[model samples]
Target: MSRQFAILGLGYFGSTVARELKRHQNQVLGVDRDETRVDALSDMLDHAVIADLTDENALKELSLEAYDAVVIDVDDDLETSVICTLHVKELGAKEIWAKAHSDAHYKLLKRLGADRVIYPEYDVGVRVAESLNYHAMVDFIRLGERQFIVELVTTQRLVDNCASVANLSIDRDALFLVAIKRGQEVIRNPADDTPLQPDDSLILMGDLQALREIGRQI
Candidate 1:
């Protein structure tokens, strides 16, 4: 279903988000103080305009309450960032996602009623570092502070001698095998006797420490 959204900045991060939202068929209003940035993304968004988000009166004119959510991405200007967050909150925006550049900025955004605080650079850096550290890790999702669901390819070390799921000897308390992807086929709740191929993808869930241990071993 299509939803209404408003992006309150037009920098690299903001423009990228606006374009992706529009690509997913959402109605996006892209606002920015920079006319050049606004014009550059005008063709991609539902409405692109040059507006100063720091001015509550100017923001009120946008009728932010009507949009399903608003994203505040003026991280370059810390004061403007928090001010916009406050304005959107007061304007009755249902959901607010704000970018924070530092720990203090995150706390301020949270105290000011931002529904979610995003640290784009930190998020990307962590994912990249994890991929580099875990050679077999394909992707992963953090479920909580210490828990994660990871996808890993069966490495040569684990596939030796035509091993099967029964040969894994995984610690039940640490990790649970959820599924296996062999070529185009996906095996959910796979049997212990299921044959493991060298290139098969394993979907497993466990604590991060346990996952990291397995990642290092295979």
Candidate 2:
């Protein structure tokens, strides 16, 4: 389903979000104080405007309440970001997402009624660290506080020890095999008798500690 969104900053992060949202067939309105930035994304977004988002009056002129969501992406200036978020919230925008540069900024945004706060750099850093720590882990997705869905490549040790899915012995209470990927073939919810092959990609969902334990053996 398509939704309407207004982005209050046209910096790299905000522009990227606008483009991606537009690509998904959503209507996106890009706003920025910098004319150059607004002009650069005019063709990419459904609408582009050069306006001072920090000015509550200017923000009110945009009819922000009509937008399904509003994104405040002024991480460079904490005060401007906070003011813009407050204005959007006061205008009764259905949802507000704000970018935070620090813990203090994050808390402020939440207090001003932001529905979501994003720390892009911090999140990317955590993902990179996870990949570096787990050599066999191809990708990782956080499912909850202590649970994750991890894509791992089967190792020689794993194949030699288990041989088949049924014979595999791990923490059944915490680990569950979700799927197996062999080249172009994907076996979803694979049967217990499924044969194991070294280097095959396995998708597993389980607790973080259990996954890490299995990671060590595999």
Candidate 3:
């Protein structure tokens, strides 16, 4: 189903989200104090407005409460970001996602009622480090404090060693093979009989340490 989103502060991060959401056929309203930024995205979003998000009257004009979700992405100006987030929350936006520059900013946003706080730089850094550490790890999603869903690219050595899911033995208490992706095909909840192939991608859910151990063995 399509959803309506209001993105405040049309900087790089906010504009990117607006464009992608618009591309996906969702209704997106892009707001920015800079006319140039709003104009640049005018053709892409459902509505592009040049307004100060921190101003309650300006926010009221947008009828932000009708938006299913609102994203606050004001960079550099932490005050503006927090104020915008608080205003959006008061406007009754169902979900609010805010970008935080630091730990303190993150906590403040959370306290202001941001449903999700994103630390883009830190997250990207962690992903880069993971990919660098494990050459075969394509991506990872943190499910909890210690659990993660990891996507690892299979190697010829791994395929030769483990012919099928049943052939690979690991601590089930710590790791679980969730799925396998080969080319465009995705095998979800693959059975033990599922054959392993070189260059295939394995999606596994498990503890971080256990995942690291599996990465080494593979």
- Candidates' TM-scores? 0.91, 0.90, 0.96
lDDT of 3 by residue, 65-103 (tens): 898988999977998998888888888888999999998
Q: List the RMSD of every prediction in angstroms.
A: 1.8, 1.9, 1.2
Q: Write the per-residue lDDT of candidate 2 for residues 1-218, one digit (tens) a residue.
A: 99999999989999999999999999999999999999999988889999998898888889999999898898489989988988889889999999999888888899989999998777788878877888898988887899999999999989999899987766889999999999999999999989999999989999999999878877
Model 2 TM-score is 0.90
Highest-TM-score candidate: 3
Residue 13 shift from truth in candidate 2, angstroms: 1.0
Query: Ten residues in a row with the worst lDDT in model 3?
Result: 162-171
Task: Compose the digit string of candidate 1's lDDT tens values, residues 1-218.
Answer: 99999999988889899999999999999999999999999888889989998999999999999999999899479989988999899999999999999888998999999999998777778888998999788889888999999999988778884488887857779899999999999999899999898889999999888888778767
| lDDT-better candidate, 1 vs 3 | 3
- What candidate 1 gets wrong by more than 4 Å, as runs, is none
Model 2: weakest 10-residue lDDT segment is 121-130
lDDT of each: 0.90, 0.90, 0.91
Candidates 1 and 2 compared: the better one by TM-score is 1
